[model samples]
Target: MRASLVPGVALLGSYPAKSLPRDLVAGLVLTALLVPQGMAYAELAGLPAITGLYTSILCLLGYAFFGPSRILVLGPDSSLGPMIAATVLPLVAADGDPRRAVALGSALALMTGAMALLAGIGKLGFIADLISKPTMIGYMNGLALTILVGQLPKLFGFSVDASGLFAELIGFAAEVAGGATVPAALAIGLGGLVVILALQRVLPKIPAVLVVVVLSIGAAAVLGLGDRGVDLVGPLPQGFPPLTIPYITLSDVPLLLAGALGITVVSLADTISTATAFAARTGQRVDGNKEMIGIGAANVAAGLFQGFPVSTSGSRTAVAEQAGARTQVTGLVGAGAISLILLLAPGLLRNLPQPTLAAVVIAASLSLADIPGTVRLYRLRRTEFSLSIAAFVGVVWLGVLPGIAVAVALSIGNVFRRAWWPYQTVLGRVPGIPGYHDVRSYPHAERLPGCPIYRFDAPVFFANARTFREQILALAESQPRPAWIIVAAEPITDVDTTAADMLRDLDLDLELNKKGVDIVFAEMKDPVRRKIDQYELTATIDPAHFYPTLDAAITAFRTTAGAEWGPAPAEEAS
Candidate 1:
């Protein structure tokens, strides 16, 4: 089926009745995770904690209506939050106006959603693979480190004013040592961190944050942490979010565009990976483009309802599955549950501390660094290791955009670097083995008895086309004048126009009716054969010369050029 029609095809009816209890449990667990996670991610984005709540409620409801996954949870994510803040901060003035922030963020969400929708419709999901595993790991590790350091000040009950990540770290350190000296603040921050870390091991699902928050607010109310200069969550509106348009302008488009670009790329990658995992786990078929449309709708709706961009949350999805959620109704239930909290119990959340929220975010951010994978990369492939480190350094110093750009550049460079000098083999037979092997590695191997067979193991393009001809000619010259030559085309995927032209020229100059220097090709794929036919390379050499099987070519060579031919010289063989 075409991608545009997938949404309609993925009908939402016929859910199991057993899913009701599962949906309720999944809703409650997801709410627990979303509540603190929303607040922390909001802080990460340089937005108010209440914005997280707004984002969570709106995005969940939106996804429930449009998302394809029964259990996928969409909301503000820790990985993307810092990137959004970094993108928007440079455009806004000091202590940016809330109206301007809302407008810019909403615009970004819409832009991102539109881009994703178009891409899905076009079936361009494979574009996500352009970001290689190494580069992604490096970029994510750097992002994780940045988030951890950036949240330090908030954890210590102080704030830093620096814009760039490195400068922020320095400013935070300087302020922590000199400017801010609240013992109670330090205690709160440290206590929160310890509590969050320890509780993660024991009561993983109890929302350690809510416990720390209730205690912190209660202590502030009783022991007066507020009097000792501890930062507190100020008055938040006690009502459900009201729908409104953000103040959009022609000038704000470009700034928001950057955020949208980043968010769209990350969201597509995340959604695809998450959806595929769940589909595999549950033995269900997930339409990639369908998931894209679902997420796009959710983002569009979120922006309209004063929410930030969202992607499938891994933690919440896991909770839904564990709670036995079997249909999209679980997401609808979650949205309803969160709505009830917003309407009836908004005041119960007033006592949450910034430090506690920061701890939760820091914990999430820490998971972004795939240290084990990085170490494995270092041991396995140094080139990929270099790319990972480069991306990490670039993201840290140059910000997310420049870092992503560098990572892509590095990836392409690596491809060209390897392709320029692809793997070449000097064929020789192993002592006990019948076929020829690479002589350089296999010392005891013998060359082809008499004929020379040279294989160029990459697509013949402008970059390595000339190298292909030169290497084969040199191989022919290195050994005793060969009776015939066979160019194995198994590894050669394609030949460009330039390469084809080069082959035509080589045929005229090298073969030229010379009985002792005939050239034949075997195992060539149909596409290359078509190009060869189109270019008339097959005409001069006779139709019988192009053998589809390597054995047929070998048999013809033996009949026409005699079977007494032994392997050609090692260095000079073609």
Candidate 2:
């Protein structure tokens, strides 16, 4: 039996002494990346910069204890920032109190964490599968554009009163046209961007964001940019994150529930994808349910510490892995470093330009765009590419939270659409081939004289029962009408009640037809066969008609249809 619920505790007994020094150094290095990113993502989420620090500390500590992956880093993520803002923005008071905004964000984290915990406990990790890869590509692309546009005002040292992505873009354009941007802030922002981009190209292994941040701060202090009408992050409150309980009324539960569920979905999806990717590189197994538990624990901790919803950071995890992190100790050490900063150097970034932070966020958002992946999707599958584009439009036009719903709906709809009009083909024996193949792909292949094999590539469910019945009948109506029709049931992993009823009706209809055609199943799995038996379908269609394989079905058909049917095509040819 396990000694504790925390996975990290179990691993501590066997922890290698050789890895400890490397883990410590990696942790310190990771703190350099985490500080600026935490603050930037907090601002991105429409919360105070310091809360980002609080979030980062608590979430890291939480994941270090509960998370299964050794190097996985959990923190406020760029992709999830706009989503957090979208969720809590509507509930903020018209006057906008930072305290209220923080409370709302914390509440969202709590709700999101609770939902994730329930999902993990229920072993519903498959919920993450709802968002297909194409949908995710589009969603992230749209979110990137949204974050980029939203950050432009900060980078330009201006503020825009805009509600959506289009309005923000228009507002930004108008502001630029009116010369409303501060030149000093723009200079700092542009300079930071240049340094970041340059370092990324010339010295990719270095912490470019950290270097740019320190340089930008030095320049700001030396040039007294704050005195020149430039906005700064100002002094942050010192010491550790205070314990917080989100104060929300019962009336707020419904909206918060919707937002929490949306955040939960995106958070789990992001976490699982990142964990799985890094696990592949390290040759480790990822337990999705355990991941959900870890992520949920992190969120819950963040919420209790006055922070917002967060997810796995792929970039940070890579940094830790590259920095030679060997265990969750790296994350714990990183969290400790942030805690020390909060305690001892809280005001170290007081003169840091907000525009530079905006630049950091913009760079992170740009990384999330995944342009190459989208292009590859387009080249590989046009229809799926179109679906991705549609998801993008939904996010850009409908807003972030609603766009999640749209993406999920599109993914599910795509599944049903494919099933409703699933690909089906007639099978024939090609001269040089073994078993059977699609006749359409091998036009020269000959069909069995009085038997036609048809294959439907999706499960037989209510959604496609009618189509299945119609298509099979149409195949029977062909010039060389089959006396016995065999279904290639290998792909039909499931058989719902509606489909079973349809099958029964079709059997009766075929019996009444003067052509005397019979329908049989080939290569059906035992579970589906059991379902058929439960449905009492054998009363109308004989149980003996079910064959374990296509070859067995063909042999039965040959024996029944007579020698004139020709020794089973392969045997005759041999």
User: Which tens-of-lDDT digit does each residue in 365-429 have in candidate 2?
Assistant: 88899889899998999989998999999999999999999999999999889989999988878
List CA RMSD, all candidates: 3.1, 2.9
Shift in Å, residue 81, candidate 1: 0.8
lDDT of 1 by residue, 113-222 (tens): 78877877788777555568898899889889889888888888888878678898889889977968567777877787788778877977666666676677787778
- The best candidate in terms of TM-score: 2
Candidate 1 segments exceeding 4 Å error = 1-11, 179-181, 202-211, 416-418, 431-436, 481-483, 510-518, 540-542, 563-574
| Steric overlap count per candidate | 11, 0
Clashing pairs in 2: none
C-alpha positional error of residue 237 in candidate 2 after TM-score superposition, expressed in Å:
0.5
Off by over 4 Å in 2: 1-4, 510-512, 563-574
